[model samples]
Target: MTYLLICCRLLLGVVFLVAVTGKLRGPAAFTAFVSSVRRMRVLPAALARPAATAVVAAEATIVAAAAVPVHAAGVLAFATAAALLTALTAGIVTSLARGGQEPCRCFGTADTPLGARHVARNAALAAVAGTGLLAGLLAAPTGAGPLAAPVDPALAAVAAAGGAVAGALIVMLDDIVALARPHR
Candidate 1:
């Protein structure tokens, strides 16, 4: 269960970090992407850029908070992860309901098309965060409780690297598959 928490934390942190980085790497591009989604009339036309900027900032903050010690950072990371998953789920549902097939800006320009994959990943992450929250609540009480447990040095290093790789791979999975398939 502990390992599961760690894995989930790392994965969420990595995803947020990468997403922020991608958006920040090209703020204008992200804004354009947001505009593209908005063009579908999902979001109010006036709120598009501001909303996109806010999401970028939120992702940045979540990534930073998620990187700290478990006792302090873990709880916040769990909350952030849950929030992100919820947002993504909402976006997925809205897009499906609107009968649009716009590309998800989650992975920025590097991502392929948007579809069930975004929803699926968000669902899995939300489950992980929910489990972590439940486990934390069930544990014994203390001033610190246990959100900021000292991360194992070796484990932390591995988790960081693995998280980055996994996130990148997940984001690129569709592109890779498309490239692999033989032309009709």
Candidate 2:
């Protein structure tokens, strides 16, 4: 269970870090993300860029919190992750309800158009975060409580690496889908 919790934390951290890095790849990349946010049509045009920046900043914070092995930080990070995923899911739902066709600026470079997949992905992430939050609270504990059985350091390290690799593969979903599509 300890190793599993570490795996989940690392997996989610890597995913969010990759997402932020992709969007911040260049000015054009960020502008495209902002444009995608605008296309969501959830906010006034004047607020789109600011909203995008805020979202990116929030994701960066999540990466930092989730990646660093700060004591008791995992609990907070999981909660934050859950909230972020929920908000993202809401945005996707709103876009879908409005019949939006904008590409999900999810991985920055992936041109995967918004669809049911986005909602499913976000919902899945939120569930992971929720579960992690519960598990982390018990495993890591707050101040002055009995700790769970310690995890083997070597095994934990391996799990961490595996989690990161899993995240990278998940981000490549678009490319994988593209390759599988029949050529025009």
Candidate 3:
């Protein structure tokens, strides 16, 4: 159970942080992505920019808040993830119903367009968030007692850097893979 919570924390943290980084790095690209989806009628033109900005900002905020002590942070992280999942699920369902096909920028950019698979992935994350929230409520502690202690400062720094790198890679893997594909 404790291990599961830790996994959720790491996965959600890395995922959101990476997402925010990709979006932040390519704001124009993301805007273009959002606008393209809007044109496809997945989102309204009037709501595109604001919605895009809000989603990115919310992700950033979640990752940032989740970095702190577990009590409040866990709650915040859960809420943020739930909100994201709800939005993504609704968008995916609506688009599918309309026979719309648009890329999901949830992970920033992707080789494939948004579809039921992406929605399922988000739904899984939502489940993780729910589990974490429940765990936090039941167990007043963030991580297991001693094993979770901070490591040496240097090692901690290295780990943080690695997490960031891995997060970025994970978020961009689809786009990177797409670029590697042979042009038809």
Candidate 4:
């Protein structure tokens, strides 16, 4: 349970941090993200900028919350991440239903248009977040301090490494898929 919580926390933190950095890397990158939001048509064009800003803010918050070692904070962070992923999945589904082929600038500017793969990826992430939240709740310590039980240093390091690798793979999913696809 300790290792699971640690892995989940680091996985979510790394994912959110990479996402935030990709979007905010530069004015052009951010502009592209805003444009992608507008193209989704889930929200009115007037709200695109605000929506984009809110998304970035939420991702940033998740990263910060996950970084905290407190048991309560981990629970809250996982819950927030799950909610965010659910919302994102809904948006992607809605866009696809409307026959929108807008590029998903999810991890920065990319030409890959949104598709079922994006939905699947988001759903998987949401499930991971849900699992983490459940684990955190179930493993809550009885003491006043909500800190988790100390894990063996070696095991903790392994968990962190595994989480980081998973996060990186997720972040690069699009690129990996593109590379694997046979060129016309």
* Better candidate number, 2 or 3, judged by lDDT: 2
Provide TM-scores for the models. Answer: 0.79, 0.89, 0.73, 0.95
Q: What is the per-residue lDDT of model 1 for residues 1-184, given as tens digits with 9 covering 90 to 100?
A: 4444566567767778777777767767687568756754567878777777777777777777767644546667777677867876886778777886776677667445566766787787688678766665554234452444444668756766776677667656667778888999
**What residue pairs clash in candidate 1, if any at all?**
70-147, 70-148, 71-147, 71-148, 71-149, 72-147, 72-148
Residue-wise lDDT of candidate 4 within 1-184, one digit each (tens)?
9898888888888889998999999999999999999989999999999989989998998898999888888888899999899988999999999999999888887888999999999998898899999998899775554354756889989998998889889889999998999999
Q: What is the C-alpha local distance difference test score of each model? A: 0.68, 0.81, 0.69, 0.89
Model 2 residue runs over 4 Å out of place are: 142-149
Model 3 residue 118 CA deviation in Å: 0.5
Candidate 3 residues lying further than 4 Å off, grouped into runs, are 40-42, 141-184
Best candidate per TM-score, number?
A: 4
Off by over 4 Å in 1: 139-164, 179-182
Whole-model lDDT, candidate 1? Answer: 0.68
By lDDT: ranked, best first: 4, 2, 3, 1
Worst 10 residues of 1 by lDDT: 139-148
lDDT accuracy of residue 138 in candidate 1: 56
- What shift in Å separates residue 59 of candidate 2 from its native position after superposition? 0.6
